[model samples]
Target: MTQTAPVMRDPGEDGRFGDFGGRFVPEALIPACEELHDAFRDAWTDDAFREEFHHVLREFGGRPTPITYLARLSESLGVRVYAKREDLAHTGSHKINNVVGQTLLTRRMGKTRVIAETGAGQHGVATATAAARLGLDCTVYMGELDTQRQALNVFRMELLGAKVVPVTSGSRTLKDAVNEAMREWVTCVDDTHYCLGSVMGPHPFPWMVREFQSIIGHEASRQMAELGVGTPDVVVACVGGGSNAAGIFAGFADSTAELVGVEAAGGAAISGGQPGVLHGMKSMLLQSESGQIEEAESISAGLDYPGIGPEHAHLAAIGRARYVGMADEPVIEALQLLSSSEGIIPALESAHAVAWIAREAGREIPSGSTVLLNLSGRGDKDVAQVRDILKGRS
Candidate 1:
């Protein structure tokens, strides 16, 4: 196969990162998706739209997120570790970044409703927050299992006036929730914008989602430069549908930085799975010989997924990133270690990357090599689950 120059993109038509991404939705939803695509294109190019979006990010979503050096972690790992604190965002997760952008576009498109899916409920909460702020009706679809697991977030969404619809289909988790959300979007496409939480999905979604999230990498790059570190030697982030990782990797794509995407070993799609379709996009997925999506196992509710974003599939195939896997045990260990050592407790989703640094890699990342990890969210959402793990609850 011949390698071609990577394609840079405009927002609408067919959203792609290379040939890997395209809108592959149900026929009924195509026009709605196209409308969203066009709206995002115009919004992205409009200075006023850009200004309003940035203004919200600055005042509400917390723009210019800080880069914190983990001195103790660095001393222990032999690498200068820094964390891009997306966890510090208002909703305590990076999911708000995309939610804010999509909500703005939703208003611009004259949409009166917002629909979304959630795994850890971070996205649901983020979407609900945006909906409440914009006074749009919001509905969040979550797997039954997730609703139970992330009950606090479910209540949080409800408290914010968003309805949480519990889906009990398939594995009854993130994937099922995604299917439900898509179905709802198909039915209500005229008045509903599906606020996708990740850089996966089909076509314009992955592209548009990444554009919103690019703020992370963009701000981090500028901050690092100001700190007199031109570029880090490595950029690390945990990948579920690969949004946060993509966000942090986008700005550094042209630099010499070694991008690393950490996957949950129990559900390590890149290292353990084949290319397949799920939730409308084709990518690496843990699947059976019969091509059914396999059940994923990760201590982190957010990091367990059968499929990844298509661009991540492309990146993994092309060696643009070093994808590594860390199992359940080490992820727990990292969560505990971070809490004890640094007085910082990270969401288990983000801790999966910290696990890679803590135990997965055979050697410590080299001394003086600056490594930036996208700490995607706070750990408050996972306290109950972690307590269960600690107490040996099933």
Candidate 2:
């Protein structure tokens, strides 16, 4: 196969990637957004700031998460399967990568408090951990339903010294939590920073978050070279707001590796959506023909959202990355398969990618090809839920 590098460019001066991604936020929040954008731009360029960020990552969040070669799974699938083990990071997921960067940025901006929204609660836990470590106040908004489903994570955040607010409005899921968090940030913009969990929000957020999370791909690429594995034939990661996917993709974006993003079938914006504006950005969203945002349903709270990050939308539009969806049953089966075969249980969100590989490895992906799957999180928090699901099935 011929190899060509993708055209890599930062979002234009308007914070756009092609026709996707822009500051579609309320006029009242524009100044705050601009301030954040400027601060991030300046901080990102400073060597001292970069050193400090990496220092925090190494000393606190556990940087350079290893890439595990799945020997048994590889033999079973007739392909070389590897997992970039973000689940091994502190806080049990890749969410900490962005949280660490944002927390430092908040302190630099003279903010005393940080507020965030979460779906599966991983980001909330991560943010809360950073806040506690930095001695900053933290608050997290979670959908009522998600808080119930991910009760352990909710408690974990509270234990980390964050106030977890249950948002009961709208669909009572990630989107609603985001709405409430944005409202709260608007009221307290003077002293509080909205630490968006994903790469979905307006402007510098998508850009800023991606930069922080790109450590995953950078480390993976370097590790691969050191191990003499070269680049994999494909790179795969699950996408909610596309932080992990975007992060890992960033490393191989300009390379020949095929980038694939797995989304929950019940909430796949790119596969079953149209262009619409939601949560302050223009991206493919699961919306009604009348333009109302539809409620996305999925067993994985982290992947249960109506829209994706704008960069993922742009990548799909430009054929730089392929987006696929997996239903809940296959994801559950994949979770079990990985647990039994490799002794590694992945988060339900990450299981989407594993499920795709389980179904398509030898058929769609050629035999003997190489595949890198971003094991985005551990399934410790999801064990009870999956156990109940499997018990019901039996």
The best candidate by TM-score is 2
Off by over 4 Å in 2: 1-8
Candidate 2 lDDT over residue span 220-299, tens digit each: 99988888998999999999899999999999888889999999999999999998898889999999979999998899
Query: Candidate 2 local accuracy as lDDT?
Result: 0.92
Query: If scored against the real structure, what TM-score would every candidate get?
Result: 0.95, 0.98
Model 2, C-alpha of 155: deviation from truth (Å): 1.5
Would you list the C-alpha lDDT of every candidate in the order shown?
0.85, 0.92
Name the lDDT value of residue 78 in candidate 2: 93
Give the least accurate 10-residue stretch of model 1, judged by summed lDDT: 1-10
By lDDT, the best candidate is 2
